[model samples]
Structure formats: structure tokens, C-alpha cells
Target chain A: MLNKVVIILTSILLYKVGGKLSLRSQLLKGILEGCILSIINIQPAYGYELSVKLQQFGLSDVSEGSIYPILLRLQKEKLIIGEMRASESGPKRKYYKLTEKGQEALQLFTHHWTLIKGPVDNIIEQGGKTDGSN
Target chain B: MEATEIIELNNEKRTRLTEHNLKYYEDMLLYIRLNGNKSEQQTEEVLLEMLEHLLQAQEEGKTAEEVFGDDPKAYCKEVVEEIPTEKRKNQASLIMMVILQFLGFFAGSYGILGTALHYFFDIGSALTTFSIGSGLVILGIDLLLLGAFILAILKWIKQSTFSKKEIKSWVEFLQVWAISTAFIGLIVVIHFVMPSFGKEVSIPTYYLAILGVIFYVLSFLMRRKQNF
Candidate 1:
């Protein structure tokens, strides 16, 4: 009973503080990278633009700072290619485009996402049935 | 617009944007440097790319906080964590520094011990034992100091992040060069000016001074030309 109370209090404290993301965000990070790659698969983008696109997709917590490193890592892994090209607005911008490897990775992520999503969707849709039966 | 005109326009805009966000950018970069072990080149490239994004955000009328996020440290940590740790360069430099440090300590200890035995204990019969012994002690102190100085520099290098700014500024190089020149000048003045100072203008001293200047200039030029 004490353990349960402690757990409830700790969760309340975490929620009140609110800055820290739940465990879900930690799991979402890897999926976010793959999602970022898929976004790049649509169009080549600079880091900031890519970040804005992520925010547009309802990931308001995503920061521009987080994307550059991920882009660099993807480039290093040969999944994407970045090139410095002259921008009309300012100095040369490093634009990232998906490589063939990145496309393959995106395909793999999509295939895996579907596998997870289909079962989860079914289970979530059956939530009312389960509760009603209970 | 012509290519040159477009380039010039972009340059002007970038310069203006840099002026506005320079301090914010520098603080973030410094945080990265102090927290992580990264090569100077890697740091420079990362900064350059980051600056591009910062400029883009400025163009969009976004606040720095909005663009970089509230927790800059966490963002930097997240980015830095993605970079694969390179053992080769860190290991090589550490090995070289350790070797040099050991040599300094060994030589200093040897000098202190040898001089103590010869002069203080009178183990070796030498005529000018007293004066030579004092000089050896000073030499030993200098060697120990040199070792400590090198170790401090290595520690600073490990902690500090290097960037394009390091390359552009010649202050560090100039400080080293100035010290070298002043030391050589002082030695020459003492040898040539002071009548009682009987230290001859040795061939080895001349060669050493010449070699020091050559290396200094060569390194300065190389650092200027490329990211070292």
C-alpha cells in the first residue's frame, strides 16, 4: 500500500514539473529519426526546415537543435547525403537528401510501423467492447 | 540577379544575422566544448551548420529560444551522443603527451638527484660544485615547470572546444612566437651585453633558435592555411 502511494505521488510530482518527457518520448526518439528520414525522402531540406516540418506534424516538442545531429549521424551512416549549396537568403546552407540506403531504411521502417500499428489499432478499437464486457 | 550579386547579398545578410546571434551561438558551442571531447574540425563543421540554421530561424522571425529549444545543454547532449566516439586520435595524442611528460619528469628528477649527490653530498669531486649545483637545481625546477605547463595545455585542449574562431585568431600562435623570440633575444643580450657573463654564443644555441623560429613560422602558416 505504501509502495502504491509512493508511485502515485512520484507520478504527480513528475506531471507537475512537466518538463521531463515520459518514457514514451524515449521510445519515440528512434521512431522520430526514422520519421525524419521519411520526411527527407519526400524532399531535400535544410535542418531548420526539417524541424519545422516535424512541428507541423504535431511534434511541437521537437527542437531544431535535435535535428542537425541526427542529420549528421544519418549522413555519417551513409543513409543520407548533405551538400552545402548557396542559399538566396544567406551563406551556403547544408541541405540533406535521402540516399538509396535511406530509402531502403524508410521502407523497412514503414513496413515495421504497419506491423505494429495494425495490431495496436485493432486492440484500441476493441477497447469499448472489452470495457463493456467487463 | 547575377551570381556574384546574389552571393554578395547573401553574405551581407549572413553577416547581419551572425552579428545578432553570435553570442547565443558562442555560448551553446562553448557548452558543447566544455562537456564533450570533440576534435576542433568536427566542432567547426558543427558550428557552421548550426549557424546556418540559426540564420534561417532569424530570417523567419523566430526567437533564439524557439529555434534552439529551452534546454540547450540537453539538445547539445542529444546531438553529441550521436557522433561516434573516435579512439584513434584521442589515444595517439594522449600517448604523445604522456611520453613527453615522462621525459620531462625523468630529466628533472635525474638532474636534481645527480646534482644533490655531486655537490651537497660531495660524492663526486668537482671544483665548481657549489655554483653548478645551484644551476642544476634551477634547471630541474624549469624542467618540472615545463612539464606542468604542457600538462595544463593538454587538459585545456581536452576541455575546450575548438572552432573556426580559433583558426581565424592568431593570438595563441602570436603569444607562443613572442615568447620564443623574447627568450632568444634575452639570451643573445645576456651573452653579448654583459661583460661578466662568459657564456659563449654556442653553435647549438644558434641552431636551436633558428629551428624554433622556422617551426613557429611553418606552424603558423599551416594553421592559417588549413584547419589544424
Candidate 2:
């Protein structure tokens, strides 16, 4: 009985802590923006297609509707430009492409990601080694 | 086969699509308008993107709610908050409003404190006994409150960051301030001019006050109507 009560209490505590850890969402958004810039760095795509591309790359949490805001932000920053074009499928679609600045940003993001990935890999290889003996 | 037939068919298709999704679009627009403070053009752009997304979703045999989730209002609010607009004039006006409101609050408190000191503690000037100093203090308080109200209306008008046209130029703003002060000056002039006018056309102070009150109410209503 006591074991079951402790288990229930610990689960509740973890649930509360999990909900409070949404600060990582900001980190995710920054990384997602860089990923989006890199995707557009390859080819221009509309909002729906860009989101589908993200999903194809294993970003299942990004909804199609949510991508438009990021596109708007990029447009505002002059990092991307969107133009309305008649589509073969349906109505006119706004296709977005990276500007020269966006290309530079994507390159910087790639360079920084490469720099961080090595250190992160090293830490993970060490397998939680926190001892001073090294 | 004919050109007109193709146009009519397209119109029918568009109307049918709109009719099928009218409730969703209306709810989304209303929510964004109420909560996001977006301009008409911005709202229309958002709606166009949503319509395209909805059409694409329908083609895939899914409702917009299924694809984009059920809460479009919250979604639109989140989207609108992310994209910042260039509104230097609005920012300047907002800062001005804040400063003026701060000054107005201080002036009102000072006036009250001055009057209270005179009435309750007899610590103020002897000129207040003749109601000259006290009347000026009261007028100062009224002017500050009215100025704050006008600034509030200006701030509300300039909230549309999408529009380049400012609600008031510096010249127009100064004109409003001058004209309002001149009304109070008119009352002072009337009080002095009453002696020369004799008993025939003497305007009572209360009558002038009533006229001022009517003018203020009418102006407020007119301004609100114009903005909305």
C-alpha cells in the first residue's frame, strides 16, 4: 500500500515538473527557424509544403498553420521574400524563398551546429562521467 | 465550352466553398480582430492563407480543424504576436501618452493636495480666500484630466501599425490643445467683460459651465464615432 502511494505521489511530481519545463520550446523555435532557413536555402516552397517537408524530416510537432507565422517573421526580417503564384493544383499560393541574407544566416547556423555537435558528441561518448579524475 | 460559362462555374465553386466554411472563417476573423489588434489588410492576408490551407486540407479528405487543430482563434493570436510591424510613429505617440498620463496623475494629486491643505489645515496662500488661487488649481486639474482623455483617444487611433497615416500631426495636436485652453480663457474673459456689458447680456458662470460640458460631451462622442 505504501509503495503504491509513493509511486502515485512521485508520478504527480514529475507531471508538474514536466509541464514547467516548456522553456525548451524557445530553444526548439530557434533551432526550427534555422532548420527552416536551411530548407528554403535548397528550394522555394509554400507554407503547406514547407511544413510537410519538416514532417518528412521527423519534425512531427510542427503544424502546417504554425509555419506561416515563422514565414511572416522571416519576411519581416528581410531574410525571405514571398510571391503569390498561380498553382496547377488550386488557388494562388504564396511561395517563399531565401534572400541573400538568409543564405548567409543558414551558413552561419551550419557552421555553429558543426562546432556544437562535436562537443555534444564528446560529452555523450563520456556517458555521464562527472568525476574529477577525468 | 464558353468563356462566360467557365467564369460562372468558377464563381459557383468559390461561393460553395465559402458557404461550406463560413462559420470557421467568421470565428477566426472575429477572434483575431478582438484579440490581436490587426489592421483590415493584415486580417485579410491571414484569412487568405487560412483559406488556402483549408482548401488544401479538404483535398486530402481532412477538415481544417483536424489539420490545424480546433482552436483557430488561439492559433491566429499566437501567429499575430510573432510577426512584429514597423510602427515608429505609434511607438512615439504611445511614449508621449504615457508621459502625459504620468504628468496628469501628478497634477491631479497636487491640485487635490493644495485644496485639501487650504480647506482642512489652512496652510495655503491667503489668495485662496478670494477663490482666485483655488479656482486656478481646480482649472489646472480639469485641464490635465481632459488632456489625458484626448491622449487616450489618440493612442487608440494610432494603434493600427499597418497604416502609415498618423491620426494627428504636431500642428493639429497643438491646435487642439490651444483651442481647448481658449475655451477656459473665454470664461475668464466673460467674467471680466461682464462689468462692461452691464445688466442686459450678462452670462452666468453656471451657464457657461453647462455649455462647456455640452461641448465636451459632443466632441467625445464625435471623436469616438469617427475612430470606430
Best by TM-score: 1
TM-score of 1: 0.58
Candidate 2 Cα outliers beyond 4 Å, as residue runs? A1-21, A118-134, B1-22, B34-40, B86-228
CAPRI grade of model 2? incorrect
lDDT of 1 at B38: 55
Off by over 4 Å in 1: A1-22, A88-90, A125-134, B1-22, B33-42, B84-204
**What is candidate 2's CA lDDT for residue B108?**
44
Per-residue CA lDDT of candidate 1, range A86-120, in tens? 76676566688998999998887777666655655
Task: Tell the DockQ for candidate 2.
Answer: 0.19
Stretch of 10 with least lDDT, candidate 2 chain A: A12-21
Model 1 chain B weakest lDDT span, ten residues long: B197-206
**Per-residue lDDT for A16-63 in model 2, tens only?**
234332434444555677888988888888877787799899988766
**Candidate 1 residue-wise lDDT at B96:** 43
